[model samples]
Target: MIKWILILLVVAAVASLLGYHTLAGAAATGARILIGIVLVIFLLVLFGLFAVT
Candidate 1:
Protein backbone atom coordinates (compact mmCIF):
# COMPACT_ATOMS: atom_id res chain seq x y z
CA MET A 1 0.00 0.00 0.00
CA ILE A 2 2.86 2.35 0.81
CA LYS A 3 4.44 1.38 -2.47
CA TRP A 4 1.22 2.23 -4.25
CA ILE A 5 1.13 5.63 -2.55
CA LEU A 6 4.69 6.32 -3.64
CA ILE A 7 3.84 5.27 -7.18
CA LEU A 8 0.87 7.59 -7.24
CA LEU A 9 2.95 10.46 -5.91
CA VAL A 10 5.52 9.91 -8.63
CA VAL A 11 2.80 9.72 -11.24
CA ALA A 12 1.32 12.97 -9.91
CA ALA A 13 4.68 14.69 -10.13
CA VAL A 14 5.22 13.54 -13.65
CA ALA A 15 1.73 14.48 -14.69
CA SER A 16 2.11 17.92 -13.20
CA LEU A 17 5.40 18.41 -14.99
CA LEU A 18 3.71 17.48 -18.25
CA GLY A 19 0.88 19.94 -17.53
CA TYR A 20 -1.80 17.28 -17.07
CA HIS A 21 -3.41 19.14 -14.20
CA THR A 22 -6.43 16.90 -13.96
CA LEU A 23 -4.42 13.72 -13.95
CA ALA A 24 -2.02 15.11 -11.40
CA GLY A 25 -4.85 16.24 -9.17
CA ALA A 26 -6.45 12.82 -9.36
CA ALA A 27 -3.24 11.05 -8.49
CA ALA A 28 -2.57 13.43 -5.65
CA THR A 29 -6.03 12.81 -4.27
CA GLY A 30 -5.49 9.08 -4.47
CA ALA A 31 -2.19 9.39 -2.61
CA ARG A 32 -3.81 11.48 0.10
CA ILE A 33 -6.62 9.00 0.54
CA LEU A 34 -4.23 6.06 0.75
CA ILE A 35 -2.08 7.86 3.27
CA GLY A 36 -5.09 8.67 5.42
CA ILE A 37 -6.26 5.08 5.36
CA VAL A 38 -2.81 3.83 6.26
CA LEU A 39 -2.57 6.27 9.13
CA VAL A 40 -5.91 5.20 10.53
CA ILE A 41 -4.94 1.57 10.34
CA PHE A 42 -1.65 2.25 11.98
CA LEU A 43 -3.37 4.04 14.82
CA LEU A 44 -5.76 1.17 15.29
CA VAL A 45 -2.90 -1.30 15.45
CA LEU A 46 -1.06 0.87 17.92
CA PHE A 47 -4.08 0.93 20.17
CA GLY A 48 -4.32 -2.88 20.03
CA LEU A 49 -7.57 -2.75 18.16
CA PHE A 50 -6.05 -4.64 15.23
CA ALA A 51 -3.76 -6.99 17.06
CA VAL A 52 -2.31 -9.98 15.19
CA THR A 53 -2.81 -13.14 17.15
Candidate 2:
Protein backbone atom coordinates (compact mmCIF):
# COMPACT_ATOMS: atom_id res chain seq x y z
CA MET A 1 0.00 0.00 0.00
CA ILE A 2 2.78 2.39 0.92
CA LYS A 3 4.68 1.31 -2.15
CA TRP A 4 1.64 2.00 -4.29
CA ILE A 5 1.35 5.43 -2.76
CA LEU A 6 4.99 6.17 -3.53
CA ILE A 7 4.54 4.95 -7.07
CA LEU A 8 1.48 7.11 -7.54
CA LEU A 9 3.36 10.11 -6.17
CA VAL A 10 6.18 9.56 -8.61
CA VAL A 11 3.68 9.21 -11.42
CA ALA A 12 2.08 12.43 -10.34
CA ALA A 13 5.40 14.23 -10.38
CA VAL A 14 6.28 12.95 -13.80
CA ALA A 15 2.85 13.76 -15.17
CA SER A 16 3.09 17.27 -13.79
CA LEU A 17 6.50 17.73 -15.34
CA LEU A 18 5.08 16.59 -18.69
CA GLY A 19 2.11 18.98 -18.31
CA TYR A 20 -0.55 16.27 -18.01
CA HIS A 21 -2.55 18.21 -15.48
CA THR A 22 -5.46 15.79 -15.28
CA LEU A 23 -3.32 12.72 -14.84
CA ALA A 24 -1.15 14.46 -12.30
CA GLY A 25 -4.16 15.60 -10.29
CA ALA A 26 -5.67 12.11 -10.30
CA ALA A 27 -2.45 10.46 -9.23
CA ALA A 28 -1.86 13.04 -6.53
CA THR A 29 -5.36 12.50 -5.19
CA GLY A 30 -4.83 8.74 -5.13
CA ALA A 31 -1.56 9.14 -3.24
CA ARG A 32 -3.14 11.44 -0.69
CA ILE A 33 -6.02 9.03 -0.09
CA LEU A 34 -3.70 6.05 0.28
CA ILE A 35 -1.43 7.91 2.67
CA GLY A 36 -4.38 8.91 4.82
CA ILE A 37 -5.59 5.31 5.02
CA VAL A 38 -2.10 4.02 5.87
CA LEU A 39 -1.61 6.67 8.53
CA VAL A 40 -4.94 5.85 10.14
CA ILE A 41 -4.17 2.13 10.18
CA PHE A 42 -0.71 2.77 11.63
CA LEU A 43 -2.12 4.91 14.41
CA LEU A 44 -4.69 2.27 15.24
CA VAL A 45 -2.05 -0.45 15.38
CA LEU A 46 0.21 1.67 17.57
CA PHE A 47 -2.60 2.38 19.99
CA GLY A 48 -3.54 -1.28 20.11
CA LEU A 49 0.03 -2.31 20.86
CA PHE A 50 0.34 0.22 23.68
CA ALA A 51 -2.98 -0.77 25.08
CA VAL A 52 -2.02 -4.43 25.12
CA THR A 53 1.25 -3.66 26.87
Candidate 2 residue 4 C-alpha distance from true site, Å: 0.2
Q: For model 1, how does the per-residue alpha-carbon lDDT over 1-53 read when each residue is reduced to its tens digit?
A: 99999999999999999999999999999999999999999998887854755
The C-alpha lDDT values of all candidates are 0.97, 0.98
Deviation in angstroms for 37 in model 2?
0.3
Q: What local lDDT score does residue 3 receive in model 2, on the 0 to 100 scale?
A: 93
User: Residue 47 error for model 2, in Å?
Assistant: 0.4
Error of 1 at 20 (Å): 0.2
Which candidate should be chosen as best, given TM-score against the real structure? 2
TM-score of each predicted structure versus truth: 0.90, 0.96
